[model samples]
Each structure stands twice: as C-alpha cells, then as structure tokens.
Target chain A: MKNNIRVERAIHGISQQQLADSVGVSRQTINAIEKGRFVPSTVLAMKIARYFNKNVEMVFALEEGD
Target chain B: MKTSFLLPNKCKKLGKAIFVISAILGFYILFIEESYADGFLIFDSWQAVKNNIAIIGSLLGLALVAFSKERVEDELVMWLRADAMIKALWLSCVLVFLCALFLYGGIYFYYLSVAQYIVLLLYIFIFRYNMYKHIKNNEE
Candidate 1:
C-alpha cells in the first residue's frame, strides 16, 4: 500500500502529532503510515482521510505489488 | 481500538517494579543463599516460603507486563503486540525444542523451568523493541 499522508499533512499544515491526535492514534502510527511501514485498517484509513477532509482514495492508493 | 483483555497503561509501571524487585529477590535467594549451603536441594521451611513468594511474584509481574495496554492502545500498537506474541511463542517453542535435543540431566531441567517464563520475557523484549523502532523512525 502507498499513502500520500506526508503530502496531505504538508498541504493541510498539520504535524503528525496533530493528525494522530485527531484520528485517536499515536504519532508513530501516523509516521508509519507516511513511511509506508504500516498499513492502517479500514476504519483507521477512513478516519485519517476524513480528518484531512479528503476521501480515502485520495490519501491511499494501491501500489502495483501491493 | 477497543482493546480487550489488557491491563490499563498504569499497570506497566507497577508490573515493572514488581518484576525488578522479585527478580532481585529471586537472584539473592537462589545464588547468594545457595552459595553458603553445602549442596543442592537444601530448602528449609522459610526458604521454601520465600522461594514460592519470589516465583509467584515474578510470574504475576511478567503477566502484568505482557498484558498491560500501551499508553495509546491504538490499532497499530495492538497489531505490533499480536505480531510480537506470535513471534515470541514460535521462538520459545524453538528454544524448548533445542533444549530438549541438546540438553539432559539437571541442566535440562533448569532450562525447562526457565521455558515457562521465556515466552513472556521474549514477548516483552520484542514488543518493546518494535515500539522503540516505531518511535525512533519518527524522530525529527
């Protein structure tokens, strides 16, 4: 899975901590998502996307191998 | 993430204190007291009581530490915990299998005794390491 969470955060001018707090998760989780080290569950993905006022497809996308 | 069957985050500190205190007590009772004794298997009534206390305390402490919730029991932490548990069980099983194959006599029995607690210890170690890496990777 690939995510443009970093880009989204930059565009929104929010730190990882802010996003994590808004999504009811830890900052490390936001970092992991941005780094593609961890994939969020459906609910979490939806929450993150909703936090950014975007759709899930806008923040996350399927990579060729994923 | 609706974490179930996990102790509250505060339990971690209490569990850690219990583990450390009991571990030190166990070490003192096992090694220091044994050194003054002539042979093995020499347990008086008080010694037996103290030994049992140490064993039970350690077990309870490890259980608390192993099952306590993280500060934020989010999905990622839960996933890391589950992953660590699976890895810990597999590794402990392998350790026991190797010990069975290569060890015998009293030493084998010693390791077998240790096998009871190794799973939880390994779980704690691996989970904490993963958490450390997770946090470190995010450091600015």
Candidate 2:
C-alpha cells in the first residue's frame, strides 16, 4: 500500500512523534510507514486516518502492484 | 492512534535492564561453575545459584508485566508473539538436526557443548533483534 501520510503530516506541521503519540504507537512505526517498510493493520490505518480527519481511502491507497 | 498498545518508556527500560542482568548471571554460571552439566542433577551449590538467578529473573519479568502502563489487546500482542515463536521453532529444529549430524559423525562432547551454546546465543540474539526491530518499526 502507498500512502500520503508524510505529505499530510507535513502539511499539518505535525511531527511523526506527535502523531504517533496521538495514535498510541511508537514513532518508529510512523517512520516505517512513511518509509514504506511496513503496512499498518486495519485498525491502525483507520486510527491514522481519523487523526488526520480524512477518509481512509484519501490517506492510504492500494498501488497497482499491490 | 491509540496509545494503549505501546509499552511505556519506563517499561522498556526495565525490560532491558532485566535482560542485561539475566545475561550476566548466565555468563557467570557458564564460566565460573565447574560442576555445571547439561543434564539435571540433585541440588548443589551451582544449582542453588542457578535457582536464585532464575527466581530473580522471573520476579523481574513479572514485575515488568505488572507495571506496564499500556494495555494492548491480547490479539494485537499475539501477532508479534506468534512471529517470535515461529522463528524460534524454525531455528531450534535446524539446530537439533545439525547437532544430530555432529553426533552421528562422532564429534567430541566439548564440540557438542560449544555448538549448543552457540546455537542458544544465536537464538537469543535473533529473537531479541527481531523483537526490537518489530517494536521500533511499530512505534507511533
């Protein structure tokens, strides 16, 4: 899956650590997600989307390869 | 995001400390105890020391669990736990097979002992590294 999480976070001027804390995850998880090294579970993805006040589809999308 | 699943920094710090203490005790037992053997025997001085270490380690581990702040759901915790168990199972099976081959080839007892220790160390290293990576990667 590909996501615009980094861009969204940057636009909101929110650090990854802050976002991670808000969502109850470690900063490393946010880093991994931004780096495309990990895929969050459904619940986590939803939580991220909720934190951004965006729909899940807007934040995360399945790539053609996926 | 939920904060419930993540271990607090204090808990992580305690866990690391416990692991280091346990490792040190293990090394002491392995190197300083002359009567230590692969098989179990009646209680002795070495066994007494080992028992004390085991009890202390278990207490530390339990304390960590008791003091944890974040209450992650069991299901989510199971994901990482299952991964670790799978890794351990695979590694242990391979080590056992290799040990069998060595035995069949008439390797010395010392060689077998060293091999077992190396395998045990490797297993611990791999498990700890994987767990750390998993936790680090998943931090919010």
Candidate 3:
C-alpha cells in the first residue's frame, strides 16, 4: 500500500518529474505514491519496479494494516 | 499494460470546443430567443428546435466528459473513473427507484436516462477534481 519511491529516486539521483516521465505517469502520481496518499495499480507498480531495475516486492511492500 | 480505449489528450480540447459551441447554440434556441409561454408543454417548431439542440448538445458534452482521455491518463486516473462510474450507477439507480413511485412510465423512462447521464458526467468531473485538489493540497 506504500512505496519507497522517494528513497529509490533519491538513490538514483533523479527528481520526481524525471521518474514520472520514465514511468509514463504524472509527477503528481509519483508524489502521491510516495506520500502514501494513493496506491498504484499492479501495472504501474511493475513499471516503477522495472524502472529501478529492482524486484517489485523490493519497491512496494504491504503495510500491517493492509 | 496498454489500453487502446483512450484517445489522445488532444481529443479533450476538441470535446471542449464542441461542448461550448453547441451549448451556446442550444441555449440561444432554448431560452435566449424567448421561445416559450405559448404551448402546453407541446413539441411545436421552436420546442422541437430547442429540444433537439439542448438534448444533442448536452449529450455530446456528457459523452465528451465520459469518454475523453485525461491529460495524464494513468492507472490512478482509470481508478478514479471506475470509482466515479460505480458511484454514479448506484446514485442513478436510487433516483430512478425514488422517482418511479411518483411518475408514470413514459416520463419515468426519459427522466431516468437523463438522471443517469447527468449523474455520471457530473460525478466524473467532480470526483476527479476533488481527488486532484486533495493531492495538490497535500503536496503543498
């Protein structure tokens, strides 16, 4: 339900806009995901994971409440 | 995953132009020309003209709002649309059920369809705007 996208982007030394452009999504969506205000779909989550060259589980994790 | 259901974002511009122009024409024929105060809800020449214009123009506008792609069409946008559609269907059903008790068959059918279309179009924009606003405010 939450993501470490901010940390991932920080590790790659890229801005949210750059990440969004890479993932074919809006920067606001990236921001929302990072803030835990929204959850991305499986396709989007996979796309984000692929962009980081990491496993999907490594990028997105389930919260205790979820 | 890719979905071919979406038109390019440019379609939204065309949709908006159609909606505005037709809306103006519809309103001009409907109210501004004072084509009223004569018949007993009859479909006379002016009434036919007004009805055709208003119904067709609004239906086009509503379809635009319903079908046109978002400026940034993503999974979240799709989810928002699905949510709006589900809620609109429920709300429109409620309206039909409530209105059916008080109205007859012919008018009931027309009113139900209009209610559904209006609810769906209005909620699509309203829900998306509210979600966008919420995200914007949260970012700030």
Candidate 4:
C-alpha cells in the first residue's frame, strides 16, 4: 500500500515519535510506513487517519499493480 | 476501528522482571558460588539455587504472556525482532561449529569450556544490542 503519511505528518508538523506514541507503537513503525518499507495494519491505519481527521482512503491507497 | 483490547503492560512488566532476576541469578552462579566447579556440573547447593530461580522466573513469565491482554504489534517491530533472532541464531551456530572444529583439532578441554562461555556471552550481547538499536531507532 502507498500512503501519504509522511506528507500528512509534515503538513501538521507532527513528528513520527508523536504519532507513534499516540497510536501505542514504536517510532520505527512510523518510519517504516513513511519509507514504504512496511504497511500498517488496519487498526494502525485507522488511528493515523483519525489523528489527521481524514478518511483512510485519503491517507492510504493501493498503488498501481498492488 | 478500536479493538476490544489494550496493550499488555502487565506482561511486559513481568517479562522485564524475570529478565532482571535471571541476570542476577546467573551472575551469582557464575561468580559467587562456593565450589563453583561442582556447582557447574552437579546438583549442589548453588546449582539448586540457580535452578529454582530459573524455574520460578520462567513459569511466571510464561503465565504473564499467556494471560495478558492482546496488543497490536506493528509490522516493522515484528520484522526487526525476527531479523535479530535470525542473526543471533546464525552467529551462535557458527560459534558452535568453530568450537567443534577446535575440539576435533585437539584443543584442551579447559580452554574449550572458557571459549564456549565467551561465545555464548558474545552472542547474547550482540542480540540484545541489535534489538535495542532497532527499537531506539524506530522510536526516534
């Protein structure tokens, strides 16, 4: 899955650590998501979307051929 | 979507406590035992002390893990842990093979024993350090 988490976080000036703590996960997880090295679980994706007050579809989407 | 459960802090706490107690008991067994030589191989007083501590600690840890609430694990954290475990296993296996080769080449038994302990220590330290780094980096 491709996500706009990094861009969203940057717009809000929220660090990865801040987001991770809010979601009860390690910062490494956020970093991996931003780097496209990992895909977040549905729960985590929803948490991130909630934090940003955006729909999950707005933040995450399937890439072409994914 | 909110899950029906939260993080299992109790389990994590118990695991940490068990790890600390095990480390302290290990130190005593390694350095403070009277008749350390016998303690290493026989069921002597010091050996008994170590065994009891280990058994109790492990049981408690297992219980905590089994009974605790389920918590979500991030994919990245899981991957890092798996990677660290694989690396540690590989390193330990290589050390064991090297030790066997040395023994086959007629290295003295006493030196081989010391070497084996050193290798075990090194493996543990490396595994722990790598895991810590991974966790820290992710958190930063």
Candidate 5:
C-alpha cells in the first residue's frame, strides 16, 4: 500500500508526534506508515485519514505491487 | 486494538529488574558456586534447591518481559511482537534440530535444558531490536 501521510501531515502543519497522539499511536508507527515499512490496519488507516479530515482513499492508494 | 491479553506496561520495568537480578544470580550459582557440576542434582541437596530457585526466577522474569505491554500498546507493537514470536520459534526450532543431530549424552541433555529458555530470550531480543530500529529510523 502507498500512503501520503507525510504529505497530509505537512498540509495540516502537524508533527508526527502530534498526529500519533491524536490517533492514539506512537510516532514511530506513523513514521513506519509514512516510510512504507509497516502497513496500517483498516481501523488505523481510517483513523489517520479521519485525523487529516480526508477520506481513506484520498490518503492511501493501491500500489501496483499491492 | 484490544491489548488486554498483555501485562501492564509497568510490568516491563519490573520484568527487566527481575530478569537482570535473576540472571546475575543464576550465573553466580552456575559458575562461581559450581552447584550443578558437584553431582548433587538430586532434589534433597541445597544446591539443587538453589538451582531450582534460580531457574524458576529466570523463567518467571522472562515470561513477564515477553508478555508485558509496550509503553504505547498499539496495533503496530502487537504486530511486531507476533512477528518476533514467529521468528523466534523458527530460529529455536532450527537450533534444536541442529543440536539434536550433532549432540548426544549428558551434553545433549544440558543443551536441551537451556534450549527451553532460548525462545523467550530470542523473542525479547528481536522484538526490542526491531522497536529500537523503528525509533532510531524515525528520529529527526
């Protein structure tokens, strides 16, 4: 999966820690999602997108390999 | 996610302290005291009793550490833990198979005794290392 969490965080002018706190997770988790090292669950993906005031499809997209 | 199955985060600290203390005591008993090699493996001996205490303490400590929750018990942490456990099981299986093929006699029994605890130790190391790497990579 490909996610533009970094871009959304930049648009919202919030730090990873801030977004993590808002979404009830650690900053490392957010970083992992942004770096594509870890894939978030549906609930977590929805929470992250909701935090950015966007739909999940707007934030996360299907990669060719995925 | 529901992390009710894990021990409280504070247990991690207590677990570390217990593991360290028990490990040091176990080393002293196994090496300096030379209890196991004295041929007093029988349960009636003081050495046997002390050895059992050390073994139980170490096992308890490791169990606590293995099962305790992370500071932020999230889905990512749970995923890492499950991944580490599977890796640990596979690694331990390979080690046990190799030991079974190459070891025999009293030495093989010794290896078997220690092998029981290796999975927990490996899991803790792999999980903690992964968590460390995750945090390190995120540092700005």
Candidate 6:
C-alpha cells in the first residue's frame, strides 16, 4: 500500500511530530507508513484520515503489487 | 494484555545495567579459577555455576531488552518488536528441534543444560539487534 502521509504533512506545513501527536502515535510510525515499511491498522488509517480531514482513500491507496 | 505487555522505554537503562552486571558476573565465574593441570574437568564446580549464571542472566537481559518499549512506541516500533519475537521464536523452535536430538537425551538434562538457554538468547539477540539496526539505518 502507498500513502500520501508525507505529502499531506507537507501540504499542512506540519512536522512529522506534530502530525503524530495529532493522531496519537509516534513520529516513527508516521515515517514508517510514509516509507511503506509499516501498514497502519484500520483504526489508525481512519484516525490519520480524520486528522487530515480527507477520506481514507484520499490518504491511502493501493499500489499495483500491493 | 497490552497494558502489562511492556515496560516503558525509560527502563532500557535498567536493562543495560543488568546486561553489564550479568556480563561481569559471567566473566568472573568463567575466569575466577583455572586448573591447567586438571584439564577441562579441572574446575567442574565453577564451570557449572558459570553456566547457570549465564543462563539466568542472559534470559533476564534478553527478556528485558526484547519486551521493553522503544524510544518511540509507534505502530511500526510495536510491529518491529512483534516481528523480532515471531522471527526469533520460529528460528529458535527449528534450532531446538534439530539440537534436541543431542541436547535432550533420555534424562541427562544437565549434560548440556546451557545449550537451550544460550540458543534462546542468541535468537533474541540476533533478530532484535538486526531489526534495530535496520530501523536506525533507514531513519530518514
């Protein structure tokens, strides 16, 4: 799965730490998600999307191999 | 279950301290006596004690290190911990199965008592150490 977390963070002019705090996770989790090293659980995906005020699909998407 | 699953990251310092103490005691037991004239069986008493010390200390240290929270207890960090544990246990089971042929015979458990504990510690160390290295190296 691919995620637009980094791009979204940039768009919001927020640091990774800020986003992490907003979603109640650590910055490393966000970084891992952005790099595709960790896939968020459904609750976490919704939380992130909710933070960004975007649909879950807008924040996360399927890659060809995923 | 999750609430009691791990100690906070601040406890890693305690883990490190215990590891150092264990290492020191292990070495002390190993080298405190040497009977060149007695050959391998020279200090059998000390050797047994050393092995026991090694087993307990290593297990304690490995458990603390493996279960303690990371500096950042994010989903990925939790995942990594779980990943290391699963991988370690899988490899350990395979090794123990293979070694059990010799490690556990009838009832002569003490013959190679240290083998199982050492293998467990090695598995935990190898998996977690490499996983942590990967995480730190990939930090962007």
For every candidate in turn, the CA RMSD to the true structure comes to 3.7, 6.2, 4.8, 6.6, 2.9, 6.1
Give the distance in Å from residue B56's predicted Cα in candidate 5 to where it truly belongs.
1.3
User: All candidates' lDDT scores?
Assistant: 0.85, 0.64, 0.73, 0.64, 0.86, 0.69
Chain A: TM-score in each candidate? 0.95, 0.95, 0.95, 0.94, 0.96, 0.93
Give the B-chain TM-score of model 4: 0.48
- What is each candidate's fraction of native interface contacts (fnat)? 0.81, 0.24, 0.62, 0.62, 0.71, 0.43
Select the stronger candidate by DockQ from 5 and 6. 5
lDDT of 3 by residue, A1-66 (tens): 878888998899999889989889878778888898888888889999999999999999999999
lDDT of 3 by residue, B1-140 (tens): 46466666676667677677776776675447745435434355666656565667667766766677777777767777777777877776777778878888867755654663567466766667766785675463
User: Which candidate has the highest TM-score of all?
Assistant: 1
The candidate 6 chain A region of ten consecutive residues with least summed lDDT is A23-32
After superposition, candidate 5 runs with Cα above 4 Å error: B32-48
List model 2 lDDT by residue over B32-140, tens digit each.
6544544344354667667456436645643453334433322234454446557766877787777677665435554453453443344345545765776666665
lDDT of each residue in B13-98, candidate 1, tens digit only = 89989988887887787657753333334355566666766777888899999999888889989888989999999999899888
Predicted candidate 4 versus true structure: per-residue lDDT over A1-66, tens digit per residue: 899998999999998889989988767778878878778778789999999999999999999988
Per-residue CA lDDT of candidate 4, range B36-79, in tens? 34354335675666655654564555344433442445555455
State iRMS for model 4: 3.1
lDDT of 6 by residue, B69-129 (tens): 7665666666665666677777767766766665556344533444545544655576568
